[model samples]
Target: MIESPGLLLTLLAFVLVIGPLVFVHEMGHYLAARWFGVKADAFSIGFGREIAGWTDRRGTRWKLGWMPLGGYVRFAGDMNAVSQPSAEWLALPEEERNQTFQAKPVWQRAIIVAAGPVVNFLLAMLILGGFAMAYGDTRTPPVVGTVLENSAAARAGLQPGDRIVRLGDRDIHVFEDMLSYTRIHPAEKTTVAFERNGQVQTLPVTIGVDQQTDRFGNNYRIGMLGIARGDRVTVPVSLFEAPVVAVRRTGEIVSMMVETIGQIITGRRSVKELGGPLSIAKVSGEQITLGADAFVFLIALVSINLGFINLLPVPMLDGGHLLFYAIEAVRRKPVGPEVQEWAFRGGLAAILGLMLLVTFNDLGNFGLWQSLASLIG
Candidate 1:
């Protein structure tokens, strides 16, 4: 575990960020269950030995656990924290069964299972909406005010007053779009369509690559066109419109995530890019150091990511449960319990394998393994 002051701060930041996110996710399940008259046995913020806890008046044990990485809620009929049904639930009296989660309608069960991810998405929307309402969009238009000499823009015959209309197939809406799109394609040939005076013109340009370093000493290569913003515009959205903007932004992030996953699965990208708890801690610490707005924005981003990850069709996840429920709905009966048990077991194994892989990647990211190897050498 990280023990240095900076690393400790990172650890604290991870908890501060992850704690609320996990709470919100499980809270979604808890609230939905309560709404449907299902009794919750416990609501926990972590796993293993309890650090602190108290039973609520409703007999729900609210507790914090030693492991601060993840959490769950135990319903009345649950065999364990994963919400598997217990045999006792099956043999319970009608009154007791009525209060159990499995006793509810399958639709209700699906809702309860799905509510965690839904709440995560909603939490992200709320945070993003809050940001939009507070700061508004301060971005500028994608018009070239000046083209640097000997840069990609100048070489492409780009001149002052040219308004960029498109980059390849993507329609340019603002200067941020141009910068964001180009920044990833260093040293690559790209087609730029712009409006010069009254006519639209297209140009073939090779993006310039620029290497830069962050405060963390990590280096990155970014594409550069060397064009400055022509005019700035701040569009302040109404509270009503903020959520819509937030949703659109969330959609963008989700789309990018999906694309990245597809790339990874298709071998276009490496699985080494996948991050675990250490990456989150590092990024969370960096964001916290930036300021409240940046940290909250990071929270929104991570929350959305959490929601999306849980929606995957892998067993032992919220999405896996939903998938089973969908199959049950179509079949008009639940999958056999033995099949579920095996499936969940397999799911658990898959999850553990993935966790280990990502943790190894995290260790590599922190240079721990490299340090150990060098020490041994």
Candidate 2:
């Protein structure tokens, strides 16, 4: 279990990781608003009680809140952090309406809303690209590190220091290549060819599903390779080669996101895999312990997640507002207040419900719920 120092470190890492990212996200909206001549009433870091605040030269309240989960930019006439425009406030005189967000052109409003997520994704891409160029990549060699006792590898007489040449007849380029293919090919028999002590050997091994329970007691059948990776090599490249690696990494992230979404919809994956603030904190602390490079990489991944989530087409979100604004741009008139209100409400409900479920999963991941269940059972 992660102890007290790890807990404190995790909390600190959460703040350090999320704080600047959220600030950057909100700042995009603020800057866009200013550019479009819209006044922001507040620019806050975090939510809940304001521990410290001061009005800037532009009369915008810059505050740091006690709760450090998220932050926002409150445009004039907005009832809350989200850029959902206010209608009642627009009923004031022309001078007051001019300051209201509802009075802005749809194009301008859309820009302000979309800017937040755009900045986050761009920032993430930059971080990922920089890391790739700076550190290069590490990969395991196709050599056997350690074979589990009495497992398939041992039964087949496989030993350490055996360099895997191929899986079946296919040539293996790297160690991960062998691992990835093997994970999905569970419950099948395959011939593994390797070079051991200057001699080529062929070993036939049978793959099987291993049932394991998560911290929440949820069972999963995982395919095991019965080996620990030990032989590895690092490939270094010039800065010129870094962007290519970064672009590949970014593509991989997007692909994973798409695959995960599809798996969830297809029931191949469970919602229990979805994480929230607590999960982020746990990962942040663990990554920080891994090193600065790992910590930065995790932040970039989260930044991408934050960006992708905001772009979802749901009311009250940036993407939702973009959708509405696009409609208004086409029709040359805003949607009715009642309709917008209901849509926003529905979106809010969905987001809140998802938050609650993910929070439950987070607690489950921490094993708190399992402990209670054990006591009761």
Candidate 3:
């Protein structure tokens, strides 16, 4: 139900972003299968009806599907894209059975299944590193240059030219470190240690929570100490050093995701923050407008998100496959087929339910339901 120019932009941006990501993900599976001597039936970039494709020399059908949301690779013995063993593969001639996916050694199958997400992480790191190499890192010192009147810092007797040394038990190295700590603990009181006139003083300060909304209409609460930096410092980085930075960047993002997911699961964070395809499409469009660097960064962030999510120990995910392998290693055989079937069904149901919930949230974020209610009223 997208309309006109905005619809066009969303579609274009979504395809541009998702197409490469899906392609790369599936390609990882495809290449690993080839390496392991496992025959691949189809290499698809999307789901459902095929739009266009050609059969490769290796007898793999490489096709693009109409739905741009997800893609999968079907190995010779896969019951479906999830790589379940098919009856056909089970009944294959003894000689050809070796080519089937389930027939492969557990380690080989695990490698093939793992390659997809592994490639995603690598792709994000490469993009991030390239960005770092092109644009030097911008940093700001943790020194307090100014304090707003009546703000938390001023109320706590903080003055300009004080250097923040610690918050609670954590040491503050830069402005970002302080910002990150504050963002997670809005309105919470913590001890702040700062150096004044060469003397270190620790004071109890209650953080001020500010409610803010982004252009996308998502609301967030941040802790404000009302401090400002003189100027941002730009540090030049070499191409060789970029990958190291990229690794750290990816680790930081992954750590943040883990923390957020834990909070959401523990009910410490609102589920309304969960998003779906619509949110991604909107952000993709927005980032496309922001310029190549921003869009590329968004892609890397999403790629990391994708990789990490897939590795969660949930059934129907890459990590689920790994879990099964772990159990198989311990039990000296695969889990019962019936148990796997039920687990996979339940996993699919859970995935579908989450999708519905997130899609509803996306609608709310887009003001679609609000506009409709207004029209009706």
Q: Candidate 1 — which residues are off by over 4 angstroms?
A: 1-5, 80-87, 148-160, 184-191, 197-209, 221-226
- The RMSD of every model to the true structure, in order and in angstroms, is 3.2, 6.1, 3.1
Per-residue error (Å), model 1, residue 263:
2.8
Top TM-score prediction, candidate number: 3
What does candidate 2's lDDT look like per residue over 1-377, in tens digits?
A: 22333678889999989998999899989888888888888999989999999998988999999899889888778764444455667566888668767678888898999999988888887887787666667666877889898777787787888888877545666787676556545566888888988998888877656787643234555556687778568788677777676766676677558766776777766788888999899888877877898898898999888888898899977899888888889988877767887888999999999999999999997889999999999
Q: List TM-score per model, in order.
A: 0.89, 0.74, 0.89
Instruction: Give the alpha carbon lDDT tens digit for every residue of 246-295 in model 1.
Output: 89778877876886687578875568888998889988888788788888
Cα lDDT tens digits, model 3, 1-377, are 22223778878988888889888888888889889898888988888999999998978898989898989888877765445566766788976777778888888888988898999999999998887788777667888888988888898888888989899766887777787777766677889999989999999999888899766455678788888776878788798889898898788788768867776888867798899899899888878876888888889988888888888878898888888988888898888778887888888898899999999999998889999999999
Name the better of 1 and 3 by lDDT.
1
Per-model lDDT: 0.87, 0.79, 0.83
- Model 3: how far residue 199 lies from native, Å: 6.4
Question: Top model by lDDT, which number?
Answer: 1
